[model samples]
Target chain A: MIITRRTFVKAAAASGAALVLPGTAPGAPPAPVMRAVPSSGEMLPAVGLGTWITFNVGDDPVLRDECAEVIAAFFAAGGRMIDSSPMYGSSQPAIGYGLEKLGRPEALFSAEKVWTSSAADGPAQIEQSRRFWGVPRFDLVQVHNLVAWETHLETLFAMKADGRIRYVGITTSEGRRHDLFEQIMRAHPLDFVQFTYNVVDREAEERLLPLAAERGMAVIVNRPFRQGALTRQLQGETLPAWAAEIGAGTWAQFILKFILSHPSVTVAIPATTRVDHVRENVTAATGPLPDASMRDRMAAYVRDL
Target chain B: MSEWWTYRLEDFLLFSPRVYWRLFELNNAASWPLHLLTLAAGLAIVLLALRRPPGHGLWVAFILAALFAFVGWSFLWSRYAAINWAIAYVAPAFGLQALLLAIGGAARGSLAFDRRDIAGRLGLLIAVVGLVVYPLMPLLFGRPWSSAEVFGIAPDPTAIVALGVLLAASGGLVPLLFAIPLLWLLLSGLTLHAMGDSQAWLPLLAAAITVAALALRRIAR
Candidate 1:
């Protein structure tokens, strides 16, 4: 039986489903969903914060403090991982300011990337990023977009071996160069692999996701909202009543839930500027995730819309 | 992987529109009353261009040189470079523009305006827009006055005013002056476009008009 939108809404209403907004529940919030790294079994909160365009606020004191509030709100909402890159302009320094402002939460998972084309510059750049973040060491360091990957990956691997870093991985975004990404995954023993994987852009489901699963590599999904394009498209559309079943109150959560529902996805790093959005994104990890059929339905609903 | 073609313009943009505009607000706040002087200087250039006074070219170039130096240090190096790494590389080009204006226009006295020509008239109009109209863009777009990019202090208006003045002037170095401002306009336009800004076309349109005016001037000559 095909479930149309009307039938789904009617059924959900009849069932008296309660729409639970993130961090707005009457009682205590549910424990955030944590997924284990396939390589080391180290658990990470499923919904992480991405510091891309959102945190590159430069030296504007007001915007920097706003970013700090976002960090405070994220940690308060049970988020652990915060991903950034040197290519993301002032984001590293902004993160440093935020972390310093927040007194440095112990549960923070610092994930950064090495993006220089020169192999020799990798270590220096990583050290600079460390200084920018004011962190002793990063939890994960990835080769950004596979630039100078061979040398950077070797350097990261050495860092991991020397315990300078916890995990070594690689990242690609906007679904570019997946062929080379697959080759690297096949060859190297990477701890993580990050790329774009959202409800709208599911190209990863065919090969990369399976490859990560097969190779026991944790997957970090980027651009889960296509860098806000998806949400803008879905804005003002009535949330499907069945979204309550998966505990998604806002569209941000609904989209994040779809990405997290995938078994291979270890984390989805959604970048946001607003403190409320950071809270909303973190809550996506706490709720009941959609099963295989529901995941399909969610994707279909988005596609049809 | 040498797959540079795979990258989109959005990939290179690392800041949001809010942050981008805030840079101007912060710059304006830091250089508060300095904007009045810069705008006054810009207006002076427009008036000078319109009147075609003797030796006004030297004064115009000197003022533009001063403005370029100020914007290069204040806006590009001090503020924008904090968020955009590429601006650091481009700031030196602005310095080069300042030096060129000083040597070619102020020192050599090569720049001279001919209001009798169509190019000069068009150039004067562009100068007026850069001086009088560009700052009003914020009001037109519903942004606060604090975020308005003004001449001499901000890179966009400064570049636009320089382009307009260069088009009006006739000199061996006039063509050379076109390169940096045009390039800056392209870069700024692309950056604003990537941010999904409604005013992205402003710089692009200015560049197109400048190029067309130059072409028409050449054809008429």
Candidate 2:
């Protein structure tokens, strides 16, 4: 039962048998159709969970049980690709606990970061993150917020070539260093780059994002809520009828749909500390995303906000 | 923000045009603290941008003196010797500073006590769980320092889960939230320092900064 992506995907395609897993409900939710990376043929779920602030969320044993249930719900409903960072403080371990409790760590597309600044230290940090998350081999290893990125990147690039890691990347959530980030993208090869690009920060669209698509790099989004700013602004708001085109039933879905419309984006990971939010975030994966014209209208909707 | 910080901010903004920009270069934990410091400097310039660049216009002087006053008092009040370096020494300073800043932002965001705030609060709480889980990181599977050494470096996953649960409970129980994270880091650092050289004052420095930031956050609250 040696686990590798080739072996796993082979098994998945092999098993068309209607297997009833523990997490699946009676009227089980439909899993998102698998999207493959044309370059690698490796498949990723379109939506992933970001484990930034949600690490400390479930304090009550009951709440945690519910949280675990929500996670069970997430997978049963069809989602994968969980992003975490040690810089995120506690996201990795909390997710580790949830996955372990659910006994489905294998189903996850585990991505974690090592934010330590030393290039010499990047390899060790990535290894530590993998170990902490209890994943057999990480699907992705990203240099968080571009910490010691050169050091981490050099290490990760080598790791990717060696098959020690499958995908490598750098992230910029703060939106402060994106121009510099563009320079990094121009200079080196990377599988992914994460950044904040909610309606509030469209700067990524003008330069870095188009560049990612042109270069064939996967993009993961953070702060889809602008750290709750967007949600607050839209409080007491109604879902516009135009949202129906994107298949968005709620504001969460609308925001995520706006993000997914760009062909370059591989996934959008909005961190939530609660099960409902997790479920809500994952639902964005289910429906049709906005087209170019729709994206423009979505922008107009937000600008009017 | 201290007297030295003010000086650093002023000079950094007004420095000769030769600016050194390193994106995710060598020591990245240094990146965050450096970011905060640099932004603080940037803010000074930003403030000056609005006013005429008189040999120090009223607004420019107000902005400079205000930045100076703000950061100066902040640094003077901070406990750690602010020579931030690595995770052991500097990360606590930067990491906790970021945490405190976020906490301030969250509170300002009125994240606490909101009915729907449950999700955001849960996010921060999850971080607490993560912090509690931090000690076990060495014990658990690791982000190895090197790829070649991945297999050889083993982690002990036993004590950390228990510690995480315990710390998560107790840390959140404290009246002043800083006491919990600060105290946990304190005890944990002392334990690490006792065990090996790699885990010495770095842990303590991290703990101390976290505490100072938490203390300030309380005031900001």
Candidate 3:
């Protein structure tokens, strides 16, 4: 028997798949449900999958298989929201393919974005992606990086009115023009806003995160690992005991738990190339998250280290 | 060693131009020594491509330009070192690599891509990831807190799993085959580095793999 941890897990996971339900857990707590998405009034899983680098790639059978395993793991563990974009290279197709391969995309919350620089190009992209994904309607659409929001938002709103998509939102990772983002948020009826907000990058805490909380707008966190730098930072170190106090097991869970603990933050999407990472990430979704004091403590701990 | 860089492999590309840029900042702009090496390397690429035997050296030119932007200014004495001061060479390197691949592929008549092509591309990705992932083990987990007495239990199992991932990968089919997934996700690693989290040496490792792969391919041809 090879008996390697990876092999054992792979073998066990294969058998477990046959016995598991499509979306419901066999013995787990209702997967820690969240408040209904304020705009759509549909409850969304607190955790969503981020498809940045992991999903963006060449569709080798191995890559597709890895993706399929990840999507299957995500759905079986009770995840629904999947944040992706055309700008993220091949992420969209990969997700659709992975879900279709596993025969379980219906258990997904397909939230993608329109990242075109041109206002005229946004709608065409949305329509093209709809056919490409083979989904009759999109669950959510957002302006990527706030490229041409003024024009695109109107088009997105019209799509929402037509029921082509369920919700509309905006996103940005750049810090230079936050005031501009604030202005848009105040004036718009957006359902969500996605952006980078890791423990190190606390710029969003000042306004964006809190503002989303204030408006009851669902907030999605992109680049939660600070794009992998934060994780790399924790490498080779023992996870502090305080981490487990906040419901974190691995360093990944620690970082993710910190974001999930935030009152304003709705979902923190950490993209992973390996299925093991998907499993590790899902573990954080188990209830009893870090409280405010723990979050503050987490900040101090990461900052000092 | 070959006169010109084979394909687009350089010390700077190993860790992303961004890391070197940040490291340059770490030294309070004192890592000027590395910059001089970069400019020379960059010029060497151009000279080797233009003046020497011109087989398929266009990729070498990409490395030359990439190195120049990545380390030239940070090192010192390269022409246009100042321009690279404000920007990391990531974007430019991506564009040049893409152009070189396009031109090379077009020249070789590889326009139509199918399923098997995915394997080769994914191979490139694994090389990228293996280069960027493992060596970065130090950064993903903090260096174990140096202490006199063992407190609260040693590293957790996950920490063990995390740090164990740092060990240099064995040289074999697995590493080469797994390169693309590794490489593709490694770019996201930059996201972590930007946030002052992990301290991955994977990028440097990836660059080395890139060079090795290029050399191997050149010899195989």
In the range B1-221, model 2's lDDT, one tens digit per residue, is: 12333232212211111010111111222223443443343334333332324432223223223332332223212211111111234324333433442343233221122111322233233334333433343344332322110100101111111112122122222233334345545644553443333534644654444444445544655
Count clashing residue pairs per candidate: 0, 46, 52
* Winning candidate number (DockQ): 1
Q: Please provide TM-scores, in order, for all candidate models, with all chains considered together.
A: 0.93, 0.54, 0.56
What is the DockQ of the complex in model 2? 0.02
How well is each residue in B1-221 modelled by candidate 3, as lDDT tens digits? 12224322221222223322333233323443443453344334333423434342344324422432333232322211222221234334333433443343234322212112323343334423332333244444643222100100111111111111211112222233223323423653443354344443444344344445545644755
Give a tens-digit lDDT track for model 2, residues A1-305.
22234533343343221112223346756455344543365667767777654443322233345446656766765678888876654345556667879886566787777688677777777777777677777888888767677777877888888988788888876465777789998898777788888665788867776677656677788878865558868877887998987678888888887776555567788766566777777777765766666777777787886
**What DockQ results do all the predictions give, each relative to the true complex?**
0.78, 0.02, 0.02
lDDT of 3 by residue, A88-112 (tens): 6556667778877876567778888
Query: Could you give the CAPRI-style class of model 3?
Result: incorrect
lDDT of 1 by residue, B64-171 (tens): 988898899999999999899999999999999989988876656578765457877788788889888999999988888899999988999899988887887877
* Interface RMSD of structure candidate 2 (Å): 17.3
Judge candidate 2 at residue B221 and give its lDDT: 55
Candidates ranked by TM-score, best first?
A: 1, 3, 2
TM-score of chain A of 1: 0.91
Task: Tell me the deviation in Å of residue B27 in model 3.
Answer: 41
